[model samples]
Target chain A: MMRLITSGAGALLGGLMMLAGVTGPAAAQGTGSATLDAVKTRGQVLCGMSGSVPGFSLPDSQGVMRGLDADTCRAVTAAALGDAAKVKFVATTTQNRFTALQSGEVDMLSRSTTWTLGREGNLGLMFAWVNYYDGTGFLVKKSSGVKAAKEMDGATICVQPGTSTELAINDYYRLNKMKFTPILIQDQAEIQGAFLSGRCDAYSTDASALATFRFSQGPKADELLLLPDIISKEPLGAVVRKGDDKWFDVVRWTFAAMITAEEKGITQANVESFLTSTDPDIRRLLGIEGDMGKALGLDNKWAFNVIKAVGNLGEMWDRNITPMGVPRGINNLWTKGGLQYAPPLR
Target chain B: MADTHADPRMSSARSSPKRSMSFAWSDPAFRAIVWQVLIVGVVVGVIWYLISNTANNLAARRIATGFGFMDRIAGIPIGESMIPYNPAEHTYGRALLIGVLNTLKVAVIGVVLATLLGTVIGIGRLSKNWLVAKITAFYVETIRDIPLLLQLLFWYTLLQGLPSPKQALRIGDAVFLTNRGLKLPLLVWEWQHTMVLATLAVGLVGVFLWSKHAKQRQDATGVRPATWPIGCGLLIALPAIVGIVLGAPLEIELPVLRGFNFQGGLTISPEYFALLLGLVVYTAGYIAEIVRSGIEAVARGQWEAAGALGLRSGMVLRLIVLPQALRVIIPPMTSQYLNLTKNSSLAVAIGFQDIVSIANTTLNQTGQAIEGIAVIMAVYLTISLSISLFMNWYNAHIALVER
Candidate 1:
């Protein structure tokens, strides 16, 4: 107990020192490895986000990032710096996201980036944890008379470049002996605009993103049809520059804590009441026992801070994604027969 | 010339006096050489520092380096390609080559079209009629002032307002212009057409030989034989007769609407068309200014002199003033051409996959940012230098001889 108090006091002093360094250079630093030192010194987590993506990282009416992905960035900041709001969101594109993370432009890319083998094996970046399980889908206009993705032969597709959408469509069509012309654009608004204006026959992206874009259409959503073809499996997650094993483990355990919190029935409001619960799993997860946080070079209360700051993963999804009318199907806890299975916290 | 600052009375003392090999700072030549070497050394040192710093940072980050990824399969699908490409089968190198080709297609066609439009507008700006001059002047002023990117977006938006393929604007059965693109019938080529092409090539060679003969005749006897009538008969009439003899029919494949789009015809997508239109229109505004200044630099007396030689106003402007003006026009025109080519990189914003756009995708996919940037730089450098060399040669060709 004395050790916890001293460490907590030390962290507070560190935070104050960081605040004192506020007069330091405000330049966006994207340096080499040891990104943790930079984030701690700057007292802010530079997180990459696709701010145009709804239910993921879209900006709210107040211009604050409000989405599942944005909340994940907050959770990461809480674990790393003990402050949920101490993250600076840098808007990234499909093309520049990986480079931004690799170049240290952003310490964490929680931008709906898929965990691909190529990215892991080639790019010096690690997919710390899968936040959302998704699949590639096609959205076409209802008047196009196209029923299945199979019937999209000889079609022009408006797909964002530097995404799995392009590759999946190409391989899927080629395997089916179909053909397509891709209209590549970087801006999400423009790409969606192209689809609505009938510039391309179909728009191809993630199913979740397609739903978000359709929901954004308000009344005109009826004109667009979200086809039932999921061409590829996309496990979306945050990425950090590789070779930083400590940072990688910290990011991994941060998501593990949130998902574990959801499984253990710990919402932010109910979490305080359950600090006295006798469950050994609960005590260890909340940092009551065990040396789990010691291995991470963090305080035992890191997981507790994360939940208290941003709630569990389920609460985050409810706040960010439920308004978009997308039900929690595969993103539910493993106990509910979803893919979001967290390894035992102990 | 080097001693221009020396006083005449003090010239004997300063007569660039004895070529001394002293390395002292007092020696002006030695000081000049030292300063130049120091500046160059600093420049080279800074560049080396940048390169080494980048290498160290990239190594520390463990980002992949080198160009070996070029052989990897590039699953990027481009909307348009000059060469046949299969995303699954082709390598990244092939995809980059297609990007280079797409860039060249826009640049070459843009250069030709911009020059024609700019020359016309430039001449119109100098017209005696106030309306023509003001309208031309207005176009140049407004277009040059507005950003090219905004104009591209406006053009893309305007194109999106066009009807869908179902209710497309059609010119009979052979052509359709929809929001998709301009669809036009493609002529089906056969052996007969190839024969005609071969005949046309022979005719072109013959026409060049005839023009050379005409030039020699004019030089010797001052009586040049007419070359155009011969050029017409040999070039046009000969190809027609050959084609007709070989029973070449004008067979064309009209575009038929299939599941999602036209299948048989050539589609000039709105992305490419808008990019082409935007680039030509914007670059022409600058080109028009260059052309106008070039024409104006030709003295009014030169035009009167040609008129005094019994030439009509049109003939005098075309035969004398325009040729002289071209000598002034070619140098600046080359820079504008380079600008247009570089500006083509903006195609990324509008969904046209040029070298920069495709290379960007490749780098992201491969994690070779430095190599990808290097490829783009090398391609642009090669293209720009080629243009510069060609323009330099043309400039020398049209230069006036002092004699």
Candidate 2:
């Protein structure tokens, strides 16, 4: 009778402790991110993306997700699961992206999400790394004979709601002493359709997205004119839920490895030759002379696997963005006078 | 045999008398009370546990909770508003107020329109003309069967297929129809207009008093005084005379094709238009059937009795049959009204920016999903309850009064 009572008491205490651990104070203060363990067990990354975006994360003819954002997911998957193909893309809208991440529906959001103060501070999520630097662009018909956005006062513009671009356009018009009516639509396809149907005078979104849209139009691309105004800074990047510092580091370092490889003139075709190079930095990055991957709880050749799977950041951009007619102007590396700069892997 | 022959009162008292409650298992009442208490306790405990779990989970995620976000600046630009709104100058609370107003705007107009159309169609369905009856029946059946969202999308698509602003269909240069929406010249309001309108209002009060006096005089004298002459003078001629004497301003501002689109006119956006049209058309179908059933529910003898008393068909319906049918109509009518109001929430799907849409955007922007959802639920509950209370009062007013 005594042993039975003691065992029952022990079981009850263990259950209560488990419950407490699950609901502990800040996720950052928890033991570690359960995301890593979940990812390992699932053997796949549930990557959130705007699946309709042409150059960001659209599905190709073979039903394979393709774009710069898709490549970002693949790079992380290679680091996390040792195989870039072990990823499932989840189509998420602007309104549900944060919720999906918060609810643990998606492990990482590689959608073309703008990095802003409101998103980081207000939402309990963090941007891991900037993969592309873009800006809000306005697309209008060439027949309008309007040269600048200033000249197009009192224009009816089509824009998506709950976007930084919407806020930027409002601010832009207020500052320029002009007026506009924005027909807010949540779906990008609908907004584009509304624009094409002449429900609005112009369509506005990210510059890269507009470029892709125009390119996809083929012969009709000449009929549309992309305005020269960079209304808002849109630094699109990958996002991860907070309270998992270890998982956050894994994502951050994954992008850094690709960028560092780009900075070192390492191409996917030539990475195998550099695996035996005597360069100390390259050796450390590829896990030849150091245990950098051990900190992230990954294989020593995790960076090597990532490069072999998706290549460096430049190669990813060339494969996805170049076809969309988007120039790698400000998205190039620091040596090329662009914005992307990687911290030392060490 | 002698003990069984005891009096009825004595037997009742001996078998089951009123006594103080006991905790014994044999005491049925006490056992029943204990079981009920235990069940209620368990239910309350479960609710408490669930609430605590949610609170703990929210805390663990570090999600901000509360209504303090309402005071922050809302940068969402609304397309159409009945009141003044500037995203830069407005708070989230004010934006949400505008959303509520937009919802009311649609619901009020949609309710009035649906009732009018439904009643007409319901009466038409009972008409002697075969064409009229069949057409109304067809309309009711077809519209009632399709989903409201699809109907809304169809109307929106049809509106989008219209010409652009540059090539809009123009009528007399004062009205323009385009994919953007219909633009109509607005008559600028002035003090003189208000003066004329006030005189009309006073005339209405005069008519009301005159009609009451006329009814009372007829009751006393057994002879009715004519009222239409006075009504015509008060309701119609007086307002016309007031407008002429005051010279109410009649200036009209036409929509001009400015830089890229129409400017300086009352514009009806396709989103709002399609939403209203869909809601009114779909709800009228259900309401028409309710009216049909209500009229059918009235006994056929009421009509024949009035006819036998030498009353015309229209007068028979107005005097006896319709008033009786109203008791049945009103209860179901209230349900249709509530349904119309609730259906307006689907405006989010069509970009109408009703309360649900604005609240959704607000929540998404602020990252306070739980608080935002709570506000939505509370707003809807309050609105639905108020509607129910008012309809219940109206229903009671029309209900049969039993002596």
RMSD of each: 7.7, 7.4
Poorly placed runs, candidate 1 (over 4 Å): A1-33, B1-41
Which candidate ranks first by DockQ, i.e. highest? 1
- In order, the TM-score of chain B in each prediction is 0.91, 0.90
Best by lDDT: 1
Models 1 onward score TM values of 0.91, 0.91
Q: In candidate 2, what are the lDDT values of residues B235-346, reduced to their tens digit?
A: 8899889898888878999999876788888999999999999999999999898888888988888888898999998899887877788888988888888899888887
Off by over 4 Å in 2: A1-31, B1-18, B25-28, B39-43, B218-221, B240-247
* Clash-forming residue pairs, model 1: none
**Candidate 1: lDDT over CA atoms?**
0.85
lDDT of 2 by residue, A60-147 (tens): 9999889999989999999988999998898777766777776666888998889888887877788999998999988998987766
Judged by whole-model lDDT over C-alpha atoms, candidate 2 comes out at 0.83
